[model samples]
Target: MEENIDIEQLRIPEALTGPEAADFLRVVEISRLVRMHTWGNDELAYTAGELLAQCHDPYEWNVMLIARVNGVIEGCAGIAMPLDDNTELAHVTLDVLPQAEGRGMGRKLLEAAEQFVRGENRKSVLVETNHAASALAAAANEAEQIHPTSGTGYLPLSSREARFAFSAGYELERVERFSSCAIPLDEALIAQNMEATHAPHRSKYRVHQWLDACPDRWAGDIARLEQCLDRGQSPGHGDWDIAKLREAEEFSALTGRRTIVTAAECVADDALIGFTSISILNHRQDVAFQDETFVELEHKGKGVGLRIKEANMTKVMREFPEVRTIYTWNAPGNSQLLEVNAQLGFISAGITAQWRKDFNAY
Candidate 1:
């Protein structure tokens, strides 16, 4: 028999200074491990300070809830709502230890988070679960081992999260492919590619590199590209109030991050037509997350996308010696960017499904 657990919100100052700090971090560690094991994603081991920062953010509202049974932490949930646009939308994320499943601990944590959102008058909720290809493959192997069916062959991918979300009344909205590559990328191969693809257009455009901040001259140009990305990935049926983006935000000082950006400039007009960037947190120097990569409509078909990526990869290898892996996401329909990633040596890691639910429906 499993014991019922109580869910409590982990507040900032109290969680940091009080006697429960260590326990809070322990819960986070277990949740992180469960995510990695179940989703086949990167180990995003976050620190207490980072967690506190989210709680104190001015532009976003966040809450972290921990579930405990007899004073032992078993699971946790994260709730967030953007302060600006999409005011009615709240995002929820929950993770439970593998051995703790079937205990209803996850459901309890989620109910608390959803209740918190209702208190804030948020009418809609969004959540995402990453499905790794490795996990699916492993499940297929086990299904075959147990017994083989007819032409159906293997069992469809199933997860505790999907079932839980469906049971709680969430609908699948979209699915994005996850890809990654071990860094210190094969320089010889990329160099050869650069020569064959980007060399012919050398006189037309030039590549520029920066760390943490974009130059003053390119601010406006970069802002436009950022907007392009916002519109490019938006779903037709998605609901939203406003889109606030700026170049200053990207260059703003961050405590424990080093941003590396590579952009392509058209020589004729010296305009920043495209860019790609990766950020490495101080505590996780070995892992870099691909933030965004964009090329303006006018610059399309000239290989600007590949050029910036290749240039940035070269700089990261030389500048960030600790970087070992880079992870990225792409909608399967975006074949162009996917091809560029594949050419740069990224392999499919898994699938990421976006889920949403309207409070009115319930």
Candidate 2:
């Protein structure tokens, strides 16, 4: 007979030193190790503070469940549902320690996640799987390659993540490329992009910079731009308003992160045409993440994207000279943005596929 596997919901504590800190730390370690084992690196690992802030975020409802066997934690599952919008969707992350695999731990954790979302009355569930570039290329020609509906990227059917998601009744919706660029970027590249951004069409737009908080005059416009970006990806989901924007800013501060933003405004109308943001983790000064880049439909193709990205990059490199690398993700079909990234010296790091299970369809 097997020892009983107990599943319990975690109560996110107010601080890391609280009574539940030990258990929370265990979950964090297990989650970090699982990702490191899978990706062969800790490039995307999260600090405990970062994870805790995510759980405490006011804009989302976050629940974490841990699986224990004989008082030892073996795995965990986290489900996050956006409260402001997309309330019908639950994003789930399941992680099981390598040594604990093949013992039905993953299955149990996933089942718990499904049950929780069902109780919340969510209609859709989303999960992501990561694949290294080398592994993907090795299996590119295999007959079992799974292509997303977008028809632009492929994942190996032989991969464990693909097999697991498929068995769990999830469909491949889209794929994104994770790329990284070393800091102290080449002077020539920066100079060239800057020169190109000075074209007549782009000259009409001026760039604005901020360190942490958005200026009062631009807050409303920033919220609108965020909404536009959200809707551009998921038609009904970009409901960003001023309140949510402030909430996100507060969340960033709570995570001990420095938010740097650069926005482009049309001189003729004084309206924000595009914007880009980069975040630097206070705990890890050598690394940064490119959060988001958005341009109005009419302002694209005129260097708005590149201008804002470069402006933010220049500011970050100057203010934080210790930064070494910046990471970003983009859909394979986003040719324009990909081109801009390539010009900025970003190289492919890995690929991640988005999978979804629609309960309402059943």
Candidate 3:
């Protein structure tokens, strides 16, 4: 009976129960191995702990589905809803056991995820894969044609799995570079010159850490940040929104991790003028991800961006001693941010390219 098992015989579990989580971990490990075998890249493989941390959070609007046959897990798939603003799109991320390859189980699991998205009235789906999983990528491409939406894949700046995304009908959209830099925390504090440098005209803002209870304030700031994302950069496959930001914040709080958010505001006007954030991941306990840094256009060109980044880095060094390295990604053309990071001592480490494809074109 096991030998004759068909895709229909495979059970697709809706929720990631405890046992299912363990099984999913095993499946992920196997999938990672297959990825390495195909592309000779170990970075494509994710540890079981990392997978759990990403999918088990309640604040994350992630739908995890597992394919099982006769009680043995064989595959896993998940879709993360956009966190800050664009909830209409569901990002597809999936994996399957090596033995299950060439079978139709991957397609079935993908169909299930698509159905879930349609039920939620989502407009599109997005995914990133590596070359080792060409079969899986092919399945996704076929599904994209049936669904008709924008799908994208990218060469991960630091992973081998990105090659698979290239074969799955995803085109190169943009190139992004990842780099790390160390800040000299022990340096003597420069005298705070209220008027000594290229400071903004109206200055009344202070840097603050986001707390669990400040949902309303955080949500408002996230909304403003979303606007900044839209204005500062062109819209990508997935966009940001307030709901997504709330979900991300809730997830971080539940996991006991800290997301350092610094904002520059007008003191007399009491308006949020600029913002930036660094998410500390537990997987790489010694590293912090400098994410989603943005300043309003009106607030740019002044020294607010540098001031906020410097203040935030100083606070991070003092508060999180375990974090020895900070990593961030910037679009290839973003010279402005590059200058700020360079001044802070960040150096180039690697590059990742964004790839996208419109299903309608295919």
Backbone collisions counted per model: 1, 0, 12
- Score candidate 1 by lDDT: 0.74
lDDT of 3 by residue, 81-192 (tens): 7554576777776676666676666667766766777777776666644333333344443423211122223333223334444545555555565677664443543233
Please name the candidate that would achieve the greatest TM-score relative to the true structure: 2
RMSD of each: 5.3, 2.2, 7.9
Model 1 off-target regions past 4 Å? 14-18, 39-42, 138-157, 234-252
In candidate 3, stretches whose alpha carbon ends up further than 4 angstroms from where it belongs are 1-22, 27-50, 56-78, 81-88, 94-123, 129-164, 183-222, 230-248, 282-284
lDDT string for model 2 (1-362, tens) is 56888999988887899667988898889888987887776667777887888898777899999999988998999899988778899999888998888788888888889889999999899998888887787787899878897638878889988998988899998899989989988999999998988877876999999998999899999999888888775344356888878877887777788999999999999999789999998677888999889898888899888988988999999999998999998989889999999999999988989999999877
Runs of candidate 2 with Cα error greater than 4 angstroms are: 1-4, 234-237
For model 1, residues 1-362, the per-residue Cα lDDT tens digits are 65659899875455566675777677668767886786565456566666665666676798888888877887888888888667899988887887888888888887888899999999988877766686767665443221111111122335655667767877666667788888888868787777867556777988889887667677777767666666875422122212222323442354466888999889998788889998877666788888788888888878889888878877888899888888888777778988898889999987677667889987
- Error of model 2, residue 342, in angstroms: 0.8
How accurate locally is residue 94 in candidate 2, as Cα lDDT from 0 to 100? 86
**Superposition TM-score, candidate 3 onto the true structure:** 0.62
Report model 1's TM-score to 2 decimal places.
Answer: 0.86
Count of clashing pairs, candidate 2: 0
> Please, what is the whole-model Cα lDDT of each candidate in the order they appear?
0.74, 0.87, 0.61
